[model samples]
Target: MRGGFARPVISLQHAPDLHSLRALLALLALVALSGCSLFREPPAPEPVEAPIAASEAEPAASEPEAASAPEAASEPAETPGAKPAPKKPRPPLIRRHKPAPPPPVAASAPPAPPPAPLVQTHTLERGTFRTLLDSEVRKPDGKVVGRAVDMVAGPGGKPQEVVVNLQGFMGVGDRKANFPWSAVHINTPAKTPAITLALTPAQLQTPERPKSGAPQPGSPEAGPTRLPMLDANVERANGAKVGRVVDVLLGGSADPLAVVLDVSGTLEKRRTIAADWSALHFVTKNNALEAQLEMSDQQIDASPAYANDLPVRAVSPAAPPATPAAPAAPAAPAVPAHGDQ
Candidate 1:
């Protein structure tokens, strides 16, 4: 009985120690499971609703705000008497405006036309011909006889004869007569000049001038071939009519400087051009005097137009030829030396 009782007691003691170890192991396992819970990942949150576009949403009657006021009100309110959390500053509100459309473009204008060309000019010096119109006629004895009324143009547009209106007392008998141009010497100084006639006033009606009267200005002469100079047709080298002589420009000495040709019909504008007086050659065609110039249509077109107000360069007159000395009176026949005689 005592031996059995001793074995039972040892068993009971071992049993109590084993129960305490099992309790400690169970407590350690509980601590490990709580640590694992701290390390585990959390579940994902639900997605927020997307905002509606301005075009898709219904229009509001009130003034529109840049940020949604309702969204700020939906957040939780701060607690009273508690230290409030620092809030992140909201971004500044910016206004956006739609851009305006561009303006319409304008069409370009056409280019302007080119300018017209200007004309050129020149001058002459010496007096080549005499204009006897309105010049007083004086005799060799310095007696005033008559006044020259008109001139009759000869073959080359030269004055062949001059018509004179003789002065009479109180308009009793004013006779007109024709006299040779060579017979009259021009000594006229200004526009109205007096000339000297080689013949006396009585010789006017002698067979040269008609007993009735000489032809007046613009009248046809009887015997001699009289040609019209002013307003005469101007012909080109090809015998084609280029223009007409509008006027004969004279110098201070009553000499013709140039002939003004009206080339309006051949040019784009109504223009007149000046040609040198020496360059023109007069010819009789169709019983009329015509002037010819050595210029082509292209040459005339390229020339400058003439203007009456244009300034001309004054040319220096040429020196006259020296007069030959008379023969030395035959040297007096060598006046025989007294010693040789």
Candidate 2:
């Protein structure tokens, strides 16, 4: 039989080695395991959308859907471009100072009785009362009577009566008039130092005991011979030197009224003060003239100051120089005028 179709036949260029067979098997295995997808490029994945914010994701109120659901309250939304505002810090707490309450008033003191009104009082001490003796004695009408001459002390060593000398013309014909101590008001004396006399000059002149320049047989003046203690150092009962005696002033009946003391203290300045004679005692130590004042230095300083250097001695003022008499006009200048020719 004749084959019309081409007989099935094969041809090889060369026999394959063992190494080449192994390589062909590995290549066939890789091709069978892998899918066709590996041959084509992988498809690009779809992009995932990010979650939107409540302010941006929601629709505005004007939308019909948004109007149906509970309307979202309208609030201003921060723009993406603007940053959020920083929070404000709280203010610090302030503490205030409180003032203390006023002090409580003392109840027991009756709210402190309105400060007692200041009061001033003066007392008539013995030393002050005696200074009146050296002063002048005058009538109630201020009529010039005379200067106090002496003071007569009673049993208590207190002045019971005083004597004044009536000053006549030119201090001449002066007479000592006896007056009752009770009749004189030493206080309320004038600045010139004058006493008020209860009796007139005539009544005082006609005093009992003596008449017409006569001395009684037995009188106090005749009893003891006492001399004045003038220019003497005066001390106090406390042994403090007060002053020195300047002069002695007399009252009626030849008794001492007061002694003018020129005080010399720490200052060494001299000022005269009249001390009561009744309070003074004649102290003769070593035969020197000195007096011991019973009063303190304060009392002596309070006495009236004497103006005259020698107050005890009375000197009449000299008559003023006779005024010159004017000479008569020059004989009328002689009417020697032309009419006289």
Candidate 3:
């Protein structure tokens, strides 16, 4: 075995331990530091001087107001290109209260016009009517033609026609005629007016009723004619009987002004108010016929105060019993005791 095995002789004396190597390396490093060292140390930067504060007397550059203020540690600095901060919102407004308005009023209507003052009416008796029946109707040439038996008035209350007892044997027969009121002259001043013929009596007769096939005078082919206002009874709206119209007063133009009302009753005074066209309205009730009045009895009583010859005598309390005249001074005793006879 000895012949084949050869062990290498190791140089243990020259090889270094770890601690010794460290010492050698440290020594070398010190040597390198003395010379130009492998990891060279940079020279310390030049001594930097602090910025100098400006003296009170020195003119200095202006700093912005925000930059001059002391920094707050809690707030962060703003960077370029950053979004802006949001604005505070405004408070809401308050409203005022107003009062409600009042209610509206209604408008009034205008009043109507009153009646005219120029008309009136009066009533008369049938006996007075008969007395004027036989009055003579003479012509303008002084020729006697007929006698008036009755009178007729239009609805307007003006005399329009008359019934005449024409010339016959001693005025005995019933021959009669109808004449327009304009064809006669009335002497109303004569206490009884004599109806004088201003035209021929024969010309004034009512048109004769024609044959069955003839043109009717009062038909639609002919014009309308006036109706009689005579004997039309008058009344109030409440069915109260007022009066009858006896005579009518005509104006200067021969237009009827008023009709004389015959208000014949126990306490009624015959009077006339202005009788306009409304006076022709009439009514009948319970066999009593009447012409309507536009007003009531109270209204009639309150018509304008009329003056006549009747004087208002103020009666006195009669003379206080005449005081008996002191018994005529006792007649002076006639001196009988003196025996002067």
Scored by TM-score, the top model is: 1
Query: What lDDT score goes with residue 331 in model 1?
Result: 50
The C-alpha stretches of model 2 lying farther than 4 A from their native spots are 1-134, 154-156, 187-193, 200-202, 206-260, 263-341
Minimal lDDT window, size 10, model 3? 310-319
lDDT of model 1 at residue 122? 55
CA shift of 247, model 2, Å: 9.0
Let me know the TM-score candidate 3 reaches against the reference structure.
Answer: 0.35
Tens digits of lDDT, candidate 2, 1-341 = 22223332322335367676667667655565454435556776754445556676766668554223322233234567988655445555555679988899767744654633222112222323323435777787777768775554443334455657767779876666667667876543226454678776576553444566877422223112222243446676566787776655534333446566777666867666666555566543444423566655444544455544323321111223468999876655545778767
lDDT of 1: 0.60
Tens-digit lDDT track of model 1 for 228-319 = 45566778657887678665544444444667678787436787777776667777666766567766666677776665455432211122
Candidate with more favorable, higher lDDT: 1 or 3: 1
After superposition, which runs of candidate 1 have C-alpha atoms over 4 Å from their true positions? Answer: 1-122, 125-150, 156-158, 164-176, 191-196, 204-225, 237-239, 246-257, 260-274, 287-289, 296-341
Ranking by TM-score: 1, 3, 2
For 1-341, candidate 3 gives per-residue lDDT tens digits of 11222334535577578677667667765665555544466976754455556754643558422323332443344557987545345445444567767767667767776644332334321222212346777776666667665455543334567667657567654455666677655554433346666775456444555677865432211012333344545667776766565544433333444544555467756554434333454343454333456555555554432222222111111222335655555455555566565
Off by over 4 Å in 3: 1-136, 144-159, 174-176, 186-194, 201-227, 237-239, 250-254, 266-292, 302-341
Which structure is stronger by lDDT: 1 or 2? 1
Better of 1 and 2 by TM-score: 1
